[model samples]
Target: MGFGHANAGYRRLFESDGLTFGAGFPLTGANRSSPDVDAEIRLAKHAESVGFDALWARDVPTYWPRFGDAGQTFDTWPWLTHVAANTDDVALGTSSVVLPLRHPIHVAKSAATVDRLSEGRLVLGVASGDRDPEYSAFGVDPDSRDEAFRHRFEAIRACWREEYPERESEWGSLEGDLDVVPKPTTETLPLLPTGNARQSREWIADNGDGWLFYHLPESTLESYIADWRELAGAKPFVIAVRVAFADDPTAEPEHLHLGYRAGVEWFREYFARLEGYGLDHVIVGLEDDDAERALSTFADDIVGEF
Candidate 1:
């Protein structure tokens, strides 16, 4: 099997024709504050039990007071390890790991460790650093991240797929003498670059195993999928949305941040429309105050309906 195709997690989550759903982490309503880790874990297990295809984790290395979102309030690597150990059979994903902020060696090693320990359940979403404050904090030049992203991406793939591969780049030099330990269960870990990562569409098509993007309107999504087909040809496309489900099954759509507030009936229709546009997967951010109830409702009504 090829690089991305060999990974069991990628296959289970993205290889199918119809759309699938994943529950985003920090499974609580708290955004600007630290989440209750015990409750979040319970919800993650419950999410898998109720048939969520995957569980998504976000990488927010630092808490920026200005940004106002702490992003699950956990380091991604250890957090994923915890989730992987506690859950069974659900794909574990980094909604994105900011590549330009960390060394590719560390990223590659940690990803491989998680993939191996999970028995092939890790899907790595790579991105250029988005928070402006984070770049300077990490001592990276924000303006040069386009170059850094490409270099780090290449380095990570090399570390995973090659045995002591001879390579030299800004990140580091591998002299073909010592191999990176705990290589992935597959030839290479599946990489889904998030939102182009400051690269051209052609670069994205050529490099990424798949593409992870933000939610766009239906008409725009259709056009984007059409263009993607023309460039990448069946490589999976994934998106995330912040959804708030109402009690009434027939409630109308109300716009929110990056998603909508709607009834289960409206969600069924909206997701079907996304499937028609050739979307492979969606990671849903459940925004309801009652997290468990919202997840249960979505699973029983919206997920199965599609």
Candidate 2:
């Protein structure tokens, strides 16, 4: 089924003509060390209170010091469960879970558990492993990632949708002898492939319920969305952006990693343009040290405007 028609988490965060906003986890600016869990949960609750549509968690299983970001410093499952219990109504998502590095059975089980606990509010963003060290560390063949990713994705879907579904792949075979219990609240959970996941655009459009991508310039985004629509139709498109909100509304934009430093006015215009470009959601990673103030300002000034 098309993502728009599916009674899944994607429906909670997307619509055809406008944009919804989500707040990224680790909700603080502490990058070198572990994030303060208390502060993050507090801000997560505050984000929901202030009308953010969702909360996103990243799956960074093994922290490689060379990569430089700790990524919420918690495993995706428990972290999402904690956030799920603490908040009401806001959608919960993994910025992405690395599919190739972990077994699909474990991912399926953990994801369904969270989906059931969250009452069908889980939008799973999945990806092929990107951190090079993780492949060897996990004893997975890096060269086989593309095939592994495809097989795992299929396994996850079968686990969610069919009882003891028989399937065969390089990963393994399910012989219809046993079932993965606690299927999603719906027949299928929403899966948004992150940044191609080593697949072609057509493959992503055909398979993923939605698409989660990195930041791109406005012209590039416009063209990309146009191409996406031709193949995937109304399937949602989501992007993650880093932002540092300046105090003045009129402050001009400056470049930052994967996003920008801008004022409320610029952001308001920028997001509206994104909405016009057929974007569905934007997950904002606040770059400021004072996450509370930044979130409050963005919600009140930018999100409120949208």
Candidate 3:
């Protein structure tokens, strides 16, 4: 009974006026396939010219080659359907999508045909995958990823609300009007539920619309996201970090393998303890030498102080 923001092109990138910026899947032109799709459409038009509010993508399959993170190694649905039909206002996610190795009705009809061809602009993240050799080559059983992420998140929310609901247990069953077509131009489809992939935190606060943490220690990640926002009653919580900036704001942390090799005033006090842990959104992850000069020095010192 919640999810609003009826797609005025995804409410100009997640409503409520401000503070949203994003990143996580940035690698084009150089990913060498000789395809270059305009380097992922100029990395989604350079994250809408640095005002970025969203652009994540990652559903990597095999390449554990000693756990050397091969994210954005391409092929995530024609690279997110060509970055949601060549971005215009940003906001297009998927820092997940491992729902028991495919078939949540083809991940809800290819993310509702890329959210009705980006008019609504997708944001269905879901997860429960970890590449144990690509789920043993799709025999899909790296210990039943928490019962296949609760039967693929209840069959991708009954294939986006029943015109054919009745997806029985163990993930299978869809009779009648079988209507799982492009039903997400609005009426809801912003899924987000990355970690806690094993469910229960009151079932990811009764089916997420937010909550994807990683990289801790901001006072234990603010009492674990304030008990997941008091059990996430009003939804909206995302946190991800793996930054590496150093042009000397007094350079001093150093640890990098995933995150930390700081400076820029300790990465702006680690994004002000990630906005004192309420963190509506923060998904940085630029790596190794000049990821566009550590994302243009984190967009000129931490995206203009939030």
Candidate 4:
């Protein structure tokens, strides 16, 4: 099988039609209270039961005072473990784990552990990280984040591949003395790098197994996917969109933090455009304050509509 279709867990997500739904916000912020662990687990299971394609978790290590969005209100690793145990057969993943915040060994171990526990249902998303305050809080130079990310990426691959790989990195060194445990079920975890992250477009295409881009206009996405395909050599690509649904299909759409205001009709039309644009999969996030209403409407109106 080729890279796009090789992994069963990865392929399942793309093959689905219509709005592939996922929820955002496991975290707490000044504006929003965090969902408790049990609440999130139950919600994840509900999404699975409702036939959502995957479960996505976000990481916001340090909520910069200025950065209003505090995603997934908990430690990413432990939360992922909990979600993995609660849901069966749903692909569990991170929207993008800020790679420069933590050690590569930790990342590899956590990713492997989750993938193992989930029976190979984990997809790891990585980003160079955009929060300067979080970097500063961790005592890392934000200006050097790109370099740190590169070294960490290399280290993560090594941790997965060579047992006790000998290497020296600014992040740290693993002198052939020990290896990370709970090796990933696959030879290498499917890594979807989000945004440019200091890497050139050509490099992102060549290195990443897939691309995770923000919601984009249809024409723009067409051009971007064309560019990616030309350089990516047929790797799958994913897009994330924030959505809001109303029981009344004609209800005036509300503005979303990361997405535009649109009703189900508009969403269906947008998704059709995406399918025509050669997109492999789309992760839909409901940004509405009422989680129950958002999930219910999405499941009843969007999921089945598609």
Candidate 5:
């Protein structure tokens, strides 16, 4: 029932109980696709010092200009390995790599590489993908993604858990003659299936080390948490929230796309309620431009709640 939380990476962000807060890529300063790499690394270092439980990177394979988000502008594995090289004690995560678009063998190899290099500080988030343009570009059929996602998931796990484990999939197969080198620091990697990945809720509850859900309204989130508790038992549930800090500490919620535009005190109360509802961790995407100050304030106020 504990799944992949046995590893240090999952443990860094989640405890046996309570909630923790994390921040995603691009920090605050050079927060764009063409951000300064040096500065971003520095920001990562500083972010850990200021107390973010995890640092996440998105897995956007191509730039869908119409979609309007380039996602960190770096490949997930190398960038995460680079960040792992720089930071100490902070968990490194992939917000959700697109499983339908890539080969599972490569993903397994790359994920294991980062896990080994970081000494077990990687939490992999995987998804079936939602981008319309990406399907054709990657030569994958949109309707078939559901199956692809499932197969890729199985393939990746097989590569990690079995040495040259013979497994067949739509992506490809291992015949037990060839093996993916360098297993994860632990026996297996912690894989959190983000969104549905086009699988049933039960499949996610059964397979994922955790569930990476999107931000929802308070009432809706509460209902989902109740359902998750009934289905998943003690497995962790994580959500990504978009936040914009307001000047007033007590300002009321001005709901943005995914999160609220409010003061830290208000956010503190909001997250406290989330934790109470059985949410284990939050990955915040700061909408405000002041990254350092916002991080510091969030660490002091909202993160301090757990």
Candidate 6:
């Protein structure tokens, strides 16, 4: 299979008529937390078994106490590969890999390796670096991140799609002599530019396979999707949302950071509304003490509706 219709990860998320769902990694609830690696793998497998469409790993190079979120607390590539080994079909995703601080060649090789190993079940969510301190640590100027992000994005695409690509970039030049080995399971990986990635809407439409945005109110989302449809046609629109299930099935929705607090019934209605508004996929963040029960309930209650 090639890049578009046949890419396993992209197909799973973007196919059909309604929204698909994914679970973000380090499914822990507390701040700056990293649970046992074995438990994480088990939960990942459980998420897949219960019918989540994807599993996302975040890129947090260093743990900053001020940020208060450890973001999976593992490097993306190996963690993804390890998850791939255990779970069969769930798409392995990076919640958004910061491109400015890292070299594209390494990104290219590592991402392609995961895709090849996972049989095309990798989808990349690329982003401009978020933290100012990370930029200082990496010796990359925050202002230059705009250009650096674009260059790195292009370079990674080249490495995946071409044999010995002759490319010049701020980081390094490919002289067309050495190839980045183990090309993707498809012609190239699917790139979802995460939260603009310091790019214009036109650039995202021209380049990204999809757009991964943060959560917003439904009215606001309708406006965003309208703009996206105008600029990007039917390209997928994805978001990360936090959800909490109340003990009462009919409990009404209350506002939470980036999402809502409610019972499964209200969530069912909420997600159905999202699908109606042309939203393509949702990355689910659950804060539950009983992980297995939470995933099982979500799969049966919320996911089954869509």
Each prediction's number of clashing residue pairs: 0, 0, 0, 4, 0, 0
Q: Which segments of model 2 are wrong by more than 4 Å? A: 1-8
On residues 1-306, what C-alpha lDDT tens digit does candidate 6 reach at each position? 123534899888887777899999886554386768888888898999989999998888988888778798878999899999998999889989999988999999999899989999999999996877999999888999999999999999999889999999789899999999889888888988999788998999889888999999899989999999999888899999999889998999989888888989999999999999999999999978987788999999988887
Model 3, residue 176: C-alpha shift (Å): 6.0
Determine which window of 10 residues in candidate 1 has minimal summed lDDT: 1-10
Q: What's the C-alpha lDDT at position 196 in model 3? A: 78
- Evaluated against the true structure, the overall lDDT of model 2 is 0.88
In order, candidate lDDTs are 0.89, 0.88, 0.70, 0.75, 0.86, 0.88
User: For model 4, what is the alpha-carbon lDDT of residue 72?
Assistant: 70
User: TM-score of model 1 relative to the true fold?
Assistant: 0.97
Which ranking of candidates, highest lDDT first?
Answer: 1, 6, 2, 5, 4, 3
Off by over 4 Å in 5: 1-5, 29-32
Report the lDDT of model 3 for residue 211: 72
Model 2 Cα shift for residue 192 (angstroms): 0.4
Return the lDDT, model 1, position 158. 91
lDDT string for model 3 (78-132, tens) is 6777887777667778888888878788888888787778777677678888767
Runs off by more than 4 Å, candidate 1: 1-4
Candidate 4 lDDT at 57 equals: 81
Q: Which lDDT tens digits does candidate 5 get at residues 1-306? A: 345335787987776587888899978534346678887887788779988889999998888878778789889999999999999889999998999998999999999999989989999999988889999998999999999998989888888888769988777767899989888888889889998788888998998888999999989999988998888888889999998989998888898888889987788888989989989989998876667778888887767657
Tell me the lDDT of model 3 at 175: 70
Score residue 50 of candidate 2 by CA lDDT: 92
The global Cα lDDT (0 to 1) of model 6 is: 0.88
Mark the regions of model 4 whose C-alpha exceeds 4 Å error after superposition.
Answer: 1-8, 15-21, 27-32, 251-255
Point out the worst 10-residue segment of candidate 4 by lDDT. Answer: 24-33
lDDT accuracy of residue 130 in candidate 5: 80
Give per-residue lDDT, candidate 2, residue 188: 82
- TM-score between candidate 4 and the true structure: 0.90
Comparing candidate 4 with candidate 5, which one achieves the higher TM-score?
Answer: 5
Candidate 1's residue-wise lDDT over 39-82, tens digit each? Answer: 98999999999989999999999988888788888888899999
- Evaluated at residue 277, the lDDT of candidate 2 is 93
